[model samples]
Target: MSRKLSPSRVTSPASASVEPSTPRATRTGRRVLAGVVTSGVCLCLATVPASAADVPPVVSRGVTIPAFYTPPAELPAANGALVRTEPMSLGLAIPGLDGRPMPGTATRLMYRSTDSAGQPVAVTGTYIEPSAAWTKSGPRPLVAVASGTMGQGDQCAPSLALEHPLTLTGDTVSVGYEALAVYRILATGAAVVLTDYVGLGATDRLHTYANRLDQGHALLDAARAARKVPGASVTAASPTGLYGYSQGGGAAASAAELQPGYAPDVPVVGTYAGAPPADLTSTMKGIDGSALAGALAWSVSGFAQADPDLRAVVEANINDTGKAALKDASTMCVGDALLGYGFTKSSKWTVSGKSVAEVIAADPAAQQALDKQRIGNLTPAGPVRVATGVHDDIVPHAQARQLAVDWCRKGANVTYEPVILPNLGDKILTNHLVPLITDQGNAIDWLSDRLSGKPAVSDCWSMPLQP
Candidate 1:
């Protein structure tokens, strides 16, 4: 039996018709690129039942999340403990020429992980066991995939995306854009585990978007939990790799750094962190008034959820408009955000008409909380490939490059690749997203080499000279 969300939870201001100031040419180009990518994947619009028997569904941003996402009352003491698992459906697969299904089988799972506040939390994700054999030298490798900016809503969980590649309900829109990469990885006979982060799928709390500790722990714990899944091919000896872009890139990079002490048992051979949002201060400023401007509210809401000091600061300074925007954005997915708040300015949400970044800059406590989310402070373990588009103004190119630079200085083996492409459009997401599509093949090959025991050649010695 599915339960309806409370009236308070369902109310949102996304219905207001507000269009962004993007030029028609830029919008057309973006749509064409997006369509080409979507069509290429042969995405199916079929819907699977989102509820389990005797478990009530939870609603977020007007979308119904499966009951399997509900956490048990008492969690295990250890991190990465398996809470539950259910067979999942993949929307991107087709009947292969050989009469076997393309890609592989999927499992929707919930696992135990620690939050940014050091509290026990449930993280949801999907695990794909490839049908293809591991042709490489070692046993079947596992790649822990962290999705780019999906959103703060529970419905935006990547596990849910495996079941429904595209969701278009009233006022809510979500696309499983990561399916392309996941299917490709599966084709290589590598098992893929996709983390939904700390709170995106769990019913207990709101998603702590981009919280370094929360996201990093969730990702590493997913890798840990994947090995424990019943009948899974992945084992303790499996070579693990971390893969992500944009917000996911930060999480993967954070996991790589945190794995040395957090979960040294998970053998992470390599990490591909593309266009990581390493510096929140820079990223927040870059995202403001951009196509995905609603992300500002997500960052603030996430920080507030993890830090009480930041929450207090937010409550004191946010105007009614800001409060409404945050409330609305809390339930939004990336597509909903794009439609509802594209090119929206953060200055409108503040009491003093200052952007969220400016407000955080003024407050010592808020600045400190955000500083804690910064990556590149610690050296990442194992080989890490950091790639960024030279024209990516969304996450910003310089900060992502600086992460590789920081790791190189720390004596970590780092391969830094600068993707030089013509600027598609400024602040329209084209400049940021195009490189992700263009550089994805190279990134995958780089990680595959490391997984095959090929030593990575570091370009740290020449990084200062190139950029």
Candidate 2:
């Protein structure tokens, strides 16, 4: 009750207005609205409370959630096995976003996937079949959407966020901004599957936030699970694409790289990664003293979950303030984090009297752990479109450009689009977030073309971005 919530547009080419994270407040002083909606009935349902009796029942040795989230003890040895599925509806309503109910059928799946340790783990996500028809060329495509930074809490899962728009942790609520992107993909008449990631909503373990292997495994498996969903009418041979921004973008990128070796059965045609934090080490340094500083805490906690060596390092150096901040971040969604720790320097939390980035750089084990989370090291099996705002400070425009350079060097075809925006000094929200909104439509359109068997024409040669 006290804390439980977590929470893009492309602007016009002609004009770059003030960049707002959400919608801009009207003259009447109402909160800015997220511009995504269509006509439909609201079939919203109540979520079961998070009480002891209401906790999801355990069906396996390590799996548990609500009854809807239970996994089978006799799990399939193969990855992407559909353990259980139930039909549900998607209602779109966010405080800042203008959205309507997108009536669709939801299928809950329990599939085998690898965790951070490369061990088999059962992960759950939902596959949705929208009522729309596939008017596009080729068979109806399937999109696996990796949500942006939702939070580290189970209540912050995108699956739960879609069902209950009011889900929030602390003061920040899950506004379902990613829901807008999901609905946008749904509008294309393609069936969409949204992954809850490994531990965020699947089990009681801490979600390995931004862990490349775990995020990639969950994403690829979601596409595999979609095929087994009854009545989705999507087959194993269906053209599949990946859509995600920010954290989701990193997952999509990792999935693209891991597909050739990990899950060769799922034919992924294309992937769109917007503002992906492909290089975690640089990203940590870039965001240390910024509005999204809480993300640094999340990243540290994530590495700790996967690497014992890194965990030992963190425990040894992190002071009491840092420890408390990490604990609070474990249960917060991005919304809560934004309001709670915006613009606070990482130095305040550490005992070394240095920033988190400096602390990590000073230690070899910690640096190695952070380096392992970097994406773009391997070549993607399919065409990829990477979008980054030129003035974006949160993810760093230079690192994103460098991702294109790295991918092209490995012979992977890439379409790099640096969103041009007016320089807004000290306006962190607009510079970082505007490109996410402005380039979204273009990213989706590009992926749609690839999903329909259209060849991607990329400017693969690396060029310097204008300052």
Candidate 3:
């Protein structure tokens, strides 16, 4: 369902709200997008036995699109709380038909305040239940996940919706499946919170690229919101630990950076920043606009999102196509952008590109795209940990190393560990930047250590020379 997208626009970042179509409080959860539902979904053949008519009856009510960007009417004070109610949907193999039950479920989650600006942007996320039903832990900790980028702009699959296409699928085909992470974290009896970022999911601008503030705010805020979820059993005070790989690592790192200023009150005791691209320019230059060329899309999106100047910059040089692409990307969902809406191959439509990047790069406007790469913003307020592969390609080991160097130099209280990774190490992790993240081993164990009230380990070594 991915769509063509480009990058342009910026305002530092913020949001608002009107009388919502649905009640602020809904039983199933509120999503920002309108979804079509089919009846007779056959949710569970076992759950719904055939009736006298010998046919199962299921209801499929098209899900309502909740908001473009869900901003709380009232934001949290610097030390107060911000709540984001996320509406979610499940994955469906078949489109809805009369009386046919759709494949995914509709649910909502509440993410508390976590923005430095105290803006109440409704963060997107998916629910991670145990794959194996119940062997028995009393209750699970809520795993508040921060995902890597799909690209920048709304046209890139948005992260604002609770139900993401990738998150709903159990099978491995899902590109962003973080199911393993979710399962692993939840197997320890923890709930998972997968955020889709500020403008994604719903019909807002797609902020695909790499904006650290958006990343950090979306992530930290989700953690706060997750605390209020019913049956979630997690609290703002719950022993919390964070796991973010790639852009997620970037965001996790950013969230850590924002802790002292944004959500320092949220007890984020420990965290894992793995295979993160800590710098933007270096990462883009390192990727050399090759197959990881997708970063170009992200580059433009982030630059446009980081500050308003970027939008003005790109507008001067971007062609009509480029401008529309950037604007559309900030608001499109993955299914429409990456998946092709089943009308064509995903490759058929381009969300961003050489033409645009070249335009921006060759000119100062293009450089604006590169300039906003989310590097150079590492100043962690709490304990920090990092993990990275020695042979990473995409986010490149060098950039990861640079992040370590920059942050350490800034006295970031950083913990850096480089793993002897293989070519495309670690399952070629769904998100290309995973190898740079240093927080890879014993995820559950590490998170548990933090949730149990253990402090983060701050160990820093001289920045390993970059490749």
Candidate 4:
């Protein structure tokens, strides 16, 4: 049976929406993006079921997503209240449609969270309670898995990807590769909560791709929301850990720093931030002419979404090609983006014939926005495990190392691990992804120990970084 996603009526601050005057809201308000504010469009799903019709359905629909995702007139100020939820068998999230029994129970959840401008918004995600026993910890441990670069479209949300893995970015062999990490955390009997970020999953709003603070808010709030989920045994005292690689890594690291002020009540014990793009300015320059150059387009759109001044600057500097590329980028997932703009240079899209990096560096407003996105300004409250491949080209390994150095200087307990892989001629492709795969199991082991009350020792003393 074809089903739709329906909104659950719950009174919370996020349900009461208001005009967000933030830079992102202002720009989004002026434009008519597909998911941002659609008018009664019914988006049908090509149903993929978890089991044969005879077995109870693991997946079912509630209401049309385009209709359910749009923000309401008044959002409640309360953060992290469950808005709508539907019980989904965990197998529905696994790929290959194999009849293997699910490892746990999952609930597709829509919850309340604040956006970049501090306005309440409904954010969607999944709360999975693994059937495994909590063998090594006090109170059930929870891990909030932040996703890497998915895309700006509503379909790219992690919650959706969990259900229909292959369609997320199109041409990916193992669309459910991310599930490996989730399953790793689950193997330890720790429940996992995966977020779709602010606009990607919960609302039709343009995903504020890497708006640092906003991503941080979404991550921390996901931890808060997990406990309140029905049928889940989690509680306020459950120890929490955060894990994310690349874009997700940035969110995890940002949440670590922002936790003290943004969501202090969240008892985050450890954070594993692998190959995080902590410094956007340096990262943009590093990946400038690489195969992943489309990332530049995604980054600018994200900045413009958060700050209007940057949007105005973008409007003034971008040429027709740039405008079209931006418009095109707003609708594409990561796979489509790479294929469409692979190895493309930003200089070709600008009016003045300067590289987009150069243009952003020169403009004060753009510079400020980029600077704000950088991690390490504040120290993480608990033990932090930082991993970086020595040859990482996309997100410079130096910046990742610097994150550990900076946190150490601030008296944070930091364990810095430099992933030393044998040389592959091209550092861009292999270097960035290899560490995520190779070191992930160890990272999970480290986090599991932390949740089990094992004290973390800072490794900053051994790996000295240049000033």
Indicate which candidate wins on lDDT: 1
lDDT, residue 451, candidate 2 = 87
> TM-score for every candidate vs. truth?
0.88, 0.82, 0.64, 0.83
Going through the candidates in the order shown, the clash numbers are: 0, 19, 89, 21
lDDT of each: 0.80, 0.71, 0.47, 0.72
Model 1 poorest 10 in a row by lDDT = 39-48
CA deviation > 4 Å runs, candidate 1: 1-56, 96-100
Considering TM-score, which of the candidate structures 1 and 3 is the better prediction for this target?
1
Candidate 3 wrong stretches, greater than 4 Å: 1-107, 110-120, 126-142, 151-174, 320-378, 422-444, 455-457, 462-467
lDDT of 2 by residue, 273-353 (tens): 888888988888777777778888777776665676666666667777877677667656777778877787888887888
Error of 2 at 138 (Å): 1.6
State which candidate has the highest TM-score.
1
Query: 1 or 2, which is superior by TM-score?
Result: 1
- For residue 364, model 3's alpha carbon misses the true position, in angstroms, by 7.0
- What TM-score does candidate 3 reach? 0.64
lDDT of 3 by residue, 316-391 (tens): 4444554434333333233333432212211222334334534445666556545555554647765566777777
Task: Give candidate 2 regions above 4 Å deviation.
Answer: 1-65, 70-74, 93-103, 168-172, 425-427, 462-467
TM-score of 1: 0.88
Which TM-score value belongs to model 2? 0.82
Q: Write the per-residue lDDT of candidate 1 for residues 1-467, one digit (tens) a residue.
A: 11212112222223111123332211211211122122221111111222344344555645766677766656777898898898887897777677666788888888999887677877889988888888988999999999998987778888888789999988679899999888878878899999999777775556778888988999999999999999899999999999999999999999999999898999999999999999999999999999999898788877665576677667677777877677678778999899889999999988899988898899998898888888999989899999999999999999999999999989999999999998889999998999899999999989988888899989899897865
**lDDT (Cα, 0-100) at 194 in candidate 1:** 97
